[model samples]
Target chain A: MDEVSRKTFLLFGDSLTQRSFDEGGWGGRLASAYQRKADVIARGYSGYNTRWAAYTLEKIFTKGHVPPDLVTIFFGANDAALPDRLNGRQHVPIEEYVAHLRAFVEHIRSVGTKHIILITPPPVDETVRVQENQQKVGGEQEAAMLPERTNAVAGEYAKAVKQLGEELGIPVVDLWSNIQMQPLWQACLSDGLHFTSTGNAAVYHLVQAKINEALPHLRPDALSMDFPGHADIDASSPDSAFKGTAIS
Target chain B: MDEVSRKTFLLFGDSLTQRSFDEGGWGGRLASAYQRKADVIARGYSGYNTRWAAYTLEKIFTKGHVPPDLVTIFFGANDAALPDRLNGRQHVPIEEYVAHLRAFVEHIRSVGTKHIILITPPPVDETVRVQENQQKVGGEQEAAMLPERTNAVAGEYAKAVKQLGEELGIPVVDLWSNIQMQPLWQACLSDGLHFTSTGNAAVYHLVQAKINEALPHLRPDALSMDFPGHADIDASSPDSAFKGTAIS
Candidate 1:
């Protein structure tokens, strides 16, 4: 056995990504899946869109920091805000969203990160969003003027993300289209924007699959475990048992 | 709103703690509970006991690294292995275990972290451990000499941890005693030495309560959220809305 070292998978995004560590959330699933294989670091910034994220990205990926083995860039839920909406401060023009995303990829590359996977935002359920907002604001009259986001707008951002992934040769998880194919797509989102447990599971499955394909050698089973089996430890020098050796 | 600054909750332990990022695991629950508040860093070293962990602790807490705001040190499952067992390489003498715990707490404090929480290992269920080991080793005869751990041994370690915590004036989660108090406590351990999802949930509830009591200001709701509500964003200068302000 050889000394064991750890790699990191960085998950960067907005509220959806921030919530990915919830019970049975995708980030937790990935963390478990990569146990002993890699460190899954969640750098989720809730309510963030591409415009705001662009400012934070440079700060997050500076020269002194270690580069993650893989970085999953998931955004756009807030960026796809409906243009006409008054509180649509989260929105980013589609073109600007694309540019920011590209800049993000370049920045990651500059930091020496080797793998970058882009995840498109999941589709929104307008009916659910409307009803949820109506209850929050007390009536449909006020809700009508404050439709912060629409599925149609989110769809456009998702398309742009997929196109950017292709343009950059990075793998992309097309969550926007893939999630809707589930049996009860509407149940995936608890508040029309954020994910429920079921939605998180869907994202986990897709991301796991993409990882298996893109970085097969770094899969969970492929990494050297940090410690040896109980049967193999040398009792006299317990610490020495794992010092020069890594579990197969 | 002011710029949001997050704290950190460090989970330090063995395999049991390592698996806490699994779906419905305690670490994931904590992460969700602390969303926008803190980063829950899981530093679980599988198959490690107090002796081995003590060696690694110094390396992890060196100066210049960002100090964790809160640290939860949960070990002992592997440390409590029956002395007579052949592969009980994980065992640490009760007195030695107590010393290691103190050293860990001291090291954490030396590095500038202010809060430290200690969690005793959950009790083992011998019947399940035997059955699981029997299936792996082919028969009861082979498993007889390899009773990896016992509830009685774990109980002792738990006592030491509690006593150490009391002397140090640190908050303690007496998991060994509290978990067995649950109905069908046997269901809490998947094998004998590790936690099932049920056990993880039980631990999560206990740790959450202890954190609330010990560090109320660091609780989930007390920390600033990453961004303001969508409705509050000033569209013209959306970035300015969250620039100087932290979501409270």
Candidate 2:
């Protein structure tokens, strides 16, 4: 590919995509690793669920400064995390959550960008609170979610998502199993839910490897472009367009 | 004002605008009585201070599904309600609140639609906790705040706002004194901050009167639109946006 015509890789995820702690986030690392070839746009919002992500996707695609050559979708960590609805102490269900994720996927697909890679949630931590009331809803889906088992939830979600991606004819990077297998993945997690920068880096490198395998003709790391975490991403700068304020 | 063309009055605020209870929120009543016609776009996000309002303004503007010809800005009931940050328990300071309010103003200005109207928050209820902590940084900002002490905070916020409106060449509708004189306004407020529907009605009418006085020519009521509550708005219209896969 021509130096200036390299692909643009956009990362859309939750906290793992945004944490800049130990270093820049996973998206940041992906940018650095593929600095020369791909322009990595990080569209990560901490604590946002699939519903909010679906709502925001429209704005990101339509009003964002520069359109991307490819967009990678990831969420659900927060969708599963429902704060007790104010006063009611009610939680939005996971079934309702899957619907929201589906909507987010549809919204992204509607943008008509052929290149989209759906990534399932990273993994859940084994919390006693998460374990106490864990009930199997039945079938492979229900059977997959065991008490205090994050691996199961990740697996079920990925299975459901694989159906979605295959239906839409888009690729999916199954971060569920990919993350579970990483030797240092568990160690780098900030909580059962979040990740430290190192954890994010692991995910980023994994993504880089996947993208390289999928699009070998277009190696992201070999192209020439700006560093991911350059100090000067101002609101007025073109680079800040994707990272800055709401289009809506 | 012509009967058909009298300016439509729109009420936008917190519980103050909703009229917390029986007060029949200002906008609802204004719609019934105003000759020129007035519609209340009751954007009542209860327990929200300026931060939430700042977050909401742009969304309301961009939605454009149903826009008010004249929009009223009413807050501080909750902004004042925030306890002080230091003791991790003090009232949110007047200056700190002013900044949040300023951000709201900035976002509103950015939208550039709907004529702007500023409504001073209603006086706080006369409560003991608020009275004892009147001088305390965040005490007066919370709902249980008393009228006399909350007045000082309202006065400070109002003064800054008055100056801002004057400087910006916008309209100002002072609710402080008007609310004090009204037997209805105080009666409807549950806490110092939130209003019953009647109180909302009173404020809505007050805003209606001011907007009518300012533009005697436009009738927003005729053009009024409804703000459906968050998708889970009610039992009838469940959020279909995210349909769960629990079809079995």
| Candidate achieving the largest lDDT | 1
DockQ per candidate, 2 decimals:
0.32, 0.02
Give the root-mean-square deviation of each candidate in angstroms: 4.4, 17.7
What DockQ would candidate 1 receive versus the native complex? 0.32
lDDT of each: 0.79, 0.53
Off by over 4 Å in 2: A1-7, A20-24, A63-66, A81-99, A128-151, A221-248, B1-248
Across residues B92-140, which tens digit of lDDT does each residue of candidate 1 receive? 8899888888889987888899999999988888877777767777665
TM-score of 1: 0.88
What local lDDT score does residue A161 receive in model 1, on the 0 to 100 scale? 93
True contacts kept of each: 0.29, 0.00
Among all candidates shown, the one with the greatest TM-score: 1
| TM-scores for candidates 1 onward, in order | 0.88, 0.39
Query: Residue B93's C-alpha lDDT in candidate 2?
Result: 60
TM-scores (chain A) of the candidates: 0.91, 0.67
lDDT by residue (A95-168, candidate 1, tens digit) is 98898889889988988998989999999988777777777766657645456688877888899999998989
